[model samples]
Target chain A: MVPNREPVTGRRVQFMISCLCDAFFDDAARAAMDCLERAGCAVTCPSDQTCCGQPAYTSGDWDAYRQVVRHVAHVFHGDEPIVVASGSCATAMFHEAPIAFEGQADLPEIRRLASRTWELTDFLVNGLGVRAWSGRLPARIAVHDGCHTRGTPTIRAVRALLGGIDGLEVLAFPDQDQCCGFGGVFSISHPHISAAMGRQKVDNVRSVSPDFVVSADLSCLMHQQGIAGRQNREYPVRYVAQVLRDAAGGPA
Target chain B: MSRQALDAFAAGIESEVLEAIEIGARSGVDKRLATLTEDYADADALRRLAGQVRQHTLDHLDEYLASAEERLTSHGAQVHFAASPDRALEMILDIVRASGTRVITKSKSMASEELDLTRRLTEEGFEPVETDLGEFVVQLDGDRPSHIVKPIIHKNRRDVARSFERCGLGDYDDDPETITRRARAYMRDKFLDARVTMTGANFISAESGRVAVVTNEGNARFGLAAADVHIVLAGIDKVIPRDRDLALLLSLLIRSATGQRITSYVELVAGPRLADRPSGPREMHVIFLDANRSSVVGSDMAPILRCIRCGACMNACPVYRLSSGHAYRGVYPGPMGAVLGPLLAGNEGFAAVADLARASTFCGACRDVCPVDIPIPDLLARLRARSVREGVILARAGVPSMAGYLLLARHPRLWRLAMGLGRVLDWLPLRRLPLASIRAWFDSRTLPRWRGAQFRKDVKRGRREQEDG
Candidate 1:
């Protein structure tokens, strides 16, 4: 991990990083936490945190979706803005959570929970505004926009941070905003179509031949990685948070 | 069965058909964007206006449709209503049979395709000639239209040229202009001699009771011009409240579909050529095909009714671009088609293309580019939920998982534990797993298998260090 060159502003932004199962189960989660803490932010991990029910919400199981949203809201019910590592999970919390619990008694709380919820990139860029970083990733990287995070301002922030690195170059690949066919249960339920879409994204990646394909959302990166691994293709994918963390000398 | 369609689609991708369709699709959307940027600074606001209009019209469909019928009748056109596709075909066939209409020339009409009118006409010894160049090529080749807007989008111009030559239209070159002229030449005589012409209206204005037909080739105008009897097969959902409302709809439709400022022609046919008018059919038949669309009018998926049949969603869709339209296995193809196809199919017919809705990644590209702002992904998600409850998707993706998630996902501790185990199991050398859902998800990509409670392990180490200190 490279060290940050600029002095910390001495301002502490508290982030309750919801333990997204996908990122949590990986070293990337720790890196993100360390990245924030090293940047002079107070970060807390709610251990009882569970799934945001994005899978169920996307699957259209509103009843089950409500339960998951309810549990997440209960776990992180506070004024401290909740930050998530994945866009889909953040969407589930911010957007889908309120919609799922509309007209309910917990509507106020649900709205509050949604208002506080932010994807990691959004939190880091808007919440923290910690842009400057020093790192040694000296290669052109393609930015893959997850379906849930397309047209988001934080995406621009992520790119700006990536470009701000000492040696890294970030690119807006052709059709970078296109979904990489990782629609959670959609991938498993409709595997053939999903795989076909993944192949198309890979083809675009191959044409560019980028050293790394970074995305704000972990699910898409993870899905693309799986596809590349299965096909024995050399398409490299990385989470933007992990990359940023490594640049900030947050964690190994 | 749906899997086989996708399998064929993968093969089609290798065969270069997807590339051809994508190229055509790209040009159409590129043209649309250029036109839109020139027209409005806030295109989304315009789109929203159109959507609001469509929503209002759908809400009062009975009133507007009645107003349209009354106005069309006064303008000397007999407006007929059909309850379903079968009824619509029967009504059109009855009119054709009674009139002894031999040659039926039709401009591009997806409604005609939806009602399967051409086959019925052909079976009844009526030559149903397709006038639109793309439709003409598709008809001559004994093929179905893959795209709603550009019927022969799947085929390259070279293939179309070959088809033109094969059909004896001319010794055509691969050039699109040559093929266009050849098709026009071949269809010229059909326009001259046809007793009746069939077409679909892009929109029906209730205020004026006029049917607006939009086209690039002017074949629809030609057909209406040459033929004595004009028959319009329209989806009941096409009715808008006012004639002026077409301004927003047409602008968005043209930009979103062809990325052009406007089509070559947007003819508003109010009625038949009465006592004073020189052209148009002496008798005009406007057949409103209900076809279960009336049922969808105020229903949850009615946002799809606002679709002007713009292929922007298809062009914007990654999956549709990869597989081409044929993979959908329905009259309409792509994102909009996934919803419309099943909706048009109705309850009994839904099972045939129920899987079409499943094809989407729920990426919301369709909704984003939609001229009427249809929530395509939400409709698709609703369709998925309906399928699960109806046992259609359950039969394929399995009921156990959805059912299990509903029950166990409610328990946070249990789900976390299971996910934790899943993380550990993923890293294990468990290749070629027999779980259908798992196999399908992992078949194309390997799930990372190194989770092993990394968060917990790191936390535990931190706690140990704190205790030692």
Candidate 2:
């Protein structure tokens, strides 16, 4: 494990924009980059990078999973810290990729990447040592910890970052630790059960009735928001990057 | 036996059943955490120690099985080995047929559920009565147990009352205390009249050959004491190396299962009645059922054999809590069942229940709550890979498309082109496109119009602005 580094300005970091964020919510992706830049990091998006192979891996298609992860490892090969926008995708790269290439000759490179990788919130709070934001946002928000981030350091980082913003009332709802059921391939394969879980999570969110629902992983929020939308209800979900950036007086 | 089974169960499940399951499962999770944290100063360390003990036993299981057989045989108990469920049923049937009476009483046992013991016994013209209160209700209603520990978790008091009334045990009464009194009175008669008793061993010690059965109801003790023959049917995975190991194993089991310091009855039977003993079974038979467990012992699925059947995983699982156990379409349900079902089906039968592996959201809740720390999500993923290798048709119709997506992902240019194409096709009715997964997504959620790689464009533009400045 790499020891914690001192708070260095202009820390060169490679940003691995998750494919989900790139396609569905590009503005949020841009917001993530802005937040990183605001925290004094020089961010570079690897142009050839596309995904972390989580969808293929979680679906049990190892052939496809290995191929995509191998391509990603080559694309993001560097000594700099790798920041990911989604916790699940970060877990796929940092945790799953190395295990997938356990005995292969590329194991060293996979291990190196895994060692330097960080989820965006973890990088912002731990890597840069940014505690309190420069601006404020007065809105009640419910934070959804993605399943991959649950019981991980990323959750604590999420809480610290969200709690740092001035005037943001961070609320936790019932069964907050439960998954939103957007488990990559699971949402597609077991749609009915997935929707049922999502509906339950949305109900929990409604119980709290926060002004906005924010999550570190947009995949979960996407599923929850979709379920809410289906029922003609407005969930008003936002990515953590968007929340932090907008709260810190960065670009909307 | 595929996703169709899961779909049918989910679609047909009553709202009342779902509510009952969620409420029951949530309370189980809450009580388990509360007890573990409050009772044990270092609960996690104990759990880890128990896991190591179980893993060690599985590692040297051949030796322990032999030792256990030798110990039990020397204690004057006849020991039988069954390689399959059919052979187990045959041995059990043979024992019961010669017991001099038609009535057999049984305690709550998941192993029996695996064998469908009661149904088979009914087919063979011998009466097998479920003695445990929950199991009795399940038997009377002809419903499969949805949760391992709580047999009727999916059923409410009304369902139990209706089933009880229909079975002529009593009239329609939904009172919880009334139900318990009627069940206790009813089982008392069965226990007295039963000539043969069958019980499942929670843990069988190789050192002492003692079969430890823990129950809150104390039904196993009563049934075994009154019966002429006590037949123990246990899976080979239940054997541990020493009697002392039960201290930690039992603690983990009870705490994880029911949040109790100890069950009301911990019946430890070494052998049958001797000249010194007054009221125990005259003849005792221990049947160690392999039922494909031997093949699983040294395989990649070996870790799952350490499970203590606590049902903590099911209680923590979001998918299981929502879909209920019946959706799993097997005796085992929840995250544990997702891995166990496919592996137990053997390679030839893998295709039938392969979809169970995909039933989880990989939330890691089950793994966290598991007493033995079985990596259920990883096992589920392993099963999925096995399914892919064996060419089993999965509920995931998106498999082929996923392959195509990977192909596009491998080539950055094609991926960029697809992203751009997605924007153009955003207005098209892709939801009506006949793809099941796509239709499923569109049914509940709508995606925003694609920004055509806006992040990538912004990063490049930012670099240009920086260089120029």
Candidate 3:
């Protein structure tokens, strides 16, 4: 637990880069690393990680789901609290992993691992207990609540982080609470519906007329960005990490 | 159905469905119910108890069904069993033919919609009148209902005016009162003339053999009151163990569906009109339609049987709210429809309906808002898995690719190798790559790009810095 008690690595915490995070949202990973480490926890990127089997589990391939769960469980198999960049992946691991590995001998450990999981913003605010953010960016931002994170503790944490920032005004539309239709493989599986939903989200963002749209889950942001890109609109989507890390500068 | 439905879905999701859903949701403010549910201390307790009652009834359905039949017989109401839609239709048609009544007046029932009873009656030369205002508009326009509770939620007064004008009902009016009055005036003669009134049961109590029906329009009571022969249709699982249990269910059902303190009418009919009654149907017929429910009655998808036909899941669902009900192209649309649509259709027979299982994003919104707490997403996922297993339709990505992807995910080394290859694709123009799945997925999506060293290799530098520090 105290491995990073040394002067320079003093404030760092281990970051469990989700499979998708490691592969695609590398900027988000580095940003999360910067903000989290700067917030006084050393960032430990668990390298041996694969997916949390969210796609497979949601698809009903429980057999394949368990293999990935067990493998990921074994990799992050410690007391180090696993921080996820995507709320969906976080919920998948913490909430659903045990259900996936249900009635099995390895369930106890999976449950134990689930207990230690935390989404990035939730960790930044609740875990670190560092309020009054130093991250400053003078721009109005629209907050897109991801599909899985709605009405969860994660929403409050994301709001808290945005509110804590210096000069960052969070603008949300009336219909901002709807899903962007990024249901894991759903964006691809039901691309037409997905894009339509994403366009709806983009329109909501447009109503607010914000400089950028920010979300904890990069997948949702990417889906919205895709629609914006296709329509040749100026609404850019940014990971909450990128915004928070850029604004806060170092630490509050 | 699913193929065309998918096409409709592609078209409608981009159209004014979003505006229609928003307008309906805005006007249909669910805050009162949310507040009442929060204020009502036993809301959770009541839901659990009602769920238990429904489960108990389904568990001992045969005994209850027998009890209902026996008790209803004593009250002069005949009970019939329909094992399929065809049987149900045939049995009802024969009864109507026996009564020498070709005209039927119907109250809005999802069961009737499921049976496509209206079209059947119309085709067989029985004049069927849809009495509910929403259903009436839907009927006049020659369209299927887009929502369960508010069937014409997709239509405005202008649309209604246009529909009425098109149907030559003689008025082009956007006034609410005028529209209601006109509909009432038109339906008055049909209700008075129809000899048989057919309605769906909300709950059937075996103890008293009484059938309870809830409606906002008050047309249900009128239909039952006017007709000499009352024909009540319900799914077999709609039966409850006792009469008093209806109170607990009504509390949940009333508020959850449309957020009302209570609907305008909650009528319970047991048997037929006795000599003491002022105005009641002289002869009553109750038909419990199985319609392949026996298959789902004891299977893994059995939890769906507990549904009270409340449209809470549909209202709360983001996908459903945007696309409306018609996009589902099923009798029961939205989350509930999406779950049960394929189940009742027989996963083996219907390809279009089977594709409905894939329509959802599997968001947990529907699950969180359910009154009986039917795990809709779980059921949807289970159905999706069942679809994959049955090969009803290879989920956009064929099973072979899913299998290959799963195989790679299970192995860290293979996953890393694949990620490296994917990273190389990321470096190249993704469109130039010949990977069909990737290209198809990124067709509407800008393929995500990764930066810096792979996390597996990059983590060492952090550890090395930690050691040096």
Candidate 4:
């Protein structure tokens, strides 16, 4: 069973623009919004939804992490599913938060938040029952399954959505199963090692030489694209939402 | 701080070592996937069963320990309990001095590595030769094993050739077969000349006092036959309730470790050779090393004691792929090492190695691939929590970072206000920022122009449009 996930029951979802996407990749966030609307959901964007408390939780600051979780619980409370643009953030909320809040009085609220959280791809395919999408990307795209999404339902959701794109040639590369090394604060604490891992991923993408490197998680792409850009390599990265939006003949 | 230590270790690693680790570890990961997929009809169910068995054993470890001691004693084996690695070493020294020659042939044992047994024996004037081929190369090079199962994974063929030449084994031959042949000949002599054989038990059955030791090299069997004394050093966590438990443990262990259906050699050392069975060692000593395992059993870190020494977690670890095991700076490395390093060292060790948990991205690959389903990411997070509770600022942003983010998150208006302020980065040269964190980020990748509050604004505008229409 997928941990902390509950079956979707309605068409309404509270959209969560991950901090990374909110601050840097607004295009991807907008694309995610468009795709969610296309999937026939009454997507509600809560102005108060900020960060997912991943950084604080990962850093081991329980007091600060709880404050953030409590804030999230208050902001996104009630029955509608909370759909997130990023897989890592959704995983942090749906998976790690429950583990962190175990044995605490705040666990029930955290568990409630987790039960309603959903990644964009999983919500589109699994929650909304969009097994195949109609679109035309018309490019060779290599999929980088972020570490968090590799073994989850989102991996299949990504494949099902991408598989339906017309004229899109999906590609695979060596070590594509590896992480792109944007481990949030890990990149800050151990930048060199993180960059080394990013180099390997970027090099693997270079070997395949696809038209674009697409992933459900923008954080991974941001890290890989950064390394590739500095090295003067051709690494056009697109978020899964952006690809889906473009394929559906929406704004580029 | 140990962050510096991990960084220093990573910086010193050459490209060659990184490539070796990637190749060696990636193959283990791929093979493990292949075996688990093809070998079992219900692999995950099998894994769940294995996890349950280990958990049950740990939950009742006190009873198993007592039963194991009683059964081992009745089986004509001396059972010694060690509260720590130092105590285990001290006991081994006395047993060696009492009944063996200066030469001891040792098998590959992570438990012994914890004790630093070979070095301690050498310091005491006893010649302890590592018989595992990878370990022998490591011994010859005066280097520590970077990997758990494959000791010299960081060393390529050329490194082995150089080490062999330095040890006067043969002329420089980097051929894999030649290296194995030469090591075999060298170890054959050590096995014959040694008076004591040292090994680590994979699983000890409390019901039968049978110790199962699996190896690919077949060294333990050879050394035991030639030696008069057999010393098995194992963690107290290795104890299981019954002999039948080996069926599940051994299957998962061999497949998980090296992707083999079965190891080349499986030695179930029952006890010393009896009057009717004269083929084995004349004396046997089984030392159960606690090394804070009993304390761990009562703590949140207890699930770590379910480890079967498979090395699968390290193989699947992406951070370990780049930094390798050396960066961990402990006997155990990778996902398992990150937790075990701090826990085994007890309270004092927490201050030094608890930061190792910060080195991870908390990627779930380690947890996914773990045969016994050890929740490594959760354990790493627990370590991080412990670090914070102990007043160590090991998190990414530390307290100030969390406090700053929290202050903004608690108030929606403040979050928007601060995000608007972040838009100033769009007009400034973010790459030239004097901040170390930003500098580190911009070192390799171009920072995108901050699009602060645009998505939120768009959502608000869309709502207004619908209402107006």
Candidate 2 lDDT, tens digit per residue, B1-469? Answer: 2233575568678889999999999998998999999988988788778888998999999999999999999887999999988899999988988887788999998888889999999899988899889999988988899899999999999999999899998899999999999999988888899999999999999998999999999899999889999999999999999999999999889999988889999999999998776668999999998877888888777889999999999999988877899888887899888888877777677798997888778889998888987878878888887787677775444443476888789999998888777786578797788777677777877666677787777778888998999
Question: Chain A TM-score per candidate?
Answer: 0.87, 0.93, 0.90, 0.95
> Candidate 2 at residue A235, lDDT?
85
Question: Could you give candidate 4's per-residue lDDT for residues A15-110 as a string of tens digits?
Answer: 999998888888899999899888777888888887889888877887888888888999998899988999988888888888888899879878
Could you give the TM-score of chain B for each candidate, in order?
0.93, 0.96, 0.91, 0.96
If you assessed candidate 2 against the hidden native complex, which CAPRI class would it receive? medium
Better-scoring candidate (TM-score), 1 or 2: 2
Which lDDT tens digits does candidate 3 get at residues A68-113? 8888878876576778888888877776776666668988888777
Worst 10 residues of 2 chain B by lDDT: B1-10
DockQ of 1: 0.39
Arrange candidates by TM-score, descending.
4, 2, 1, 3
Candidate 2's DockQ is 0.59
**Fraction of native Cα contacts reproduced by each candidate:** 0.48, 0.65, 0.42, 0.73
TM-score of chain B of 3: 0.91
| Model 4 chain B: worst 10 consecutive residues (lDDT sum) | B392-401
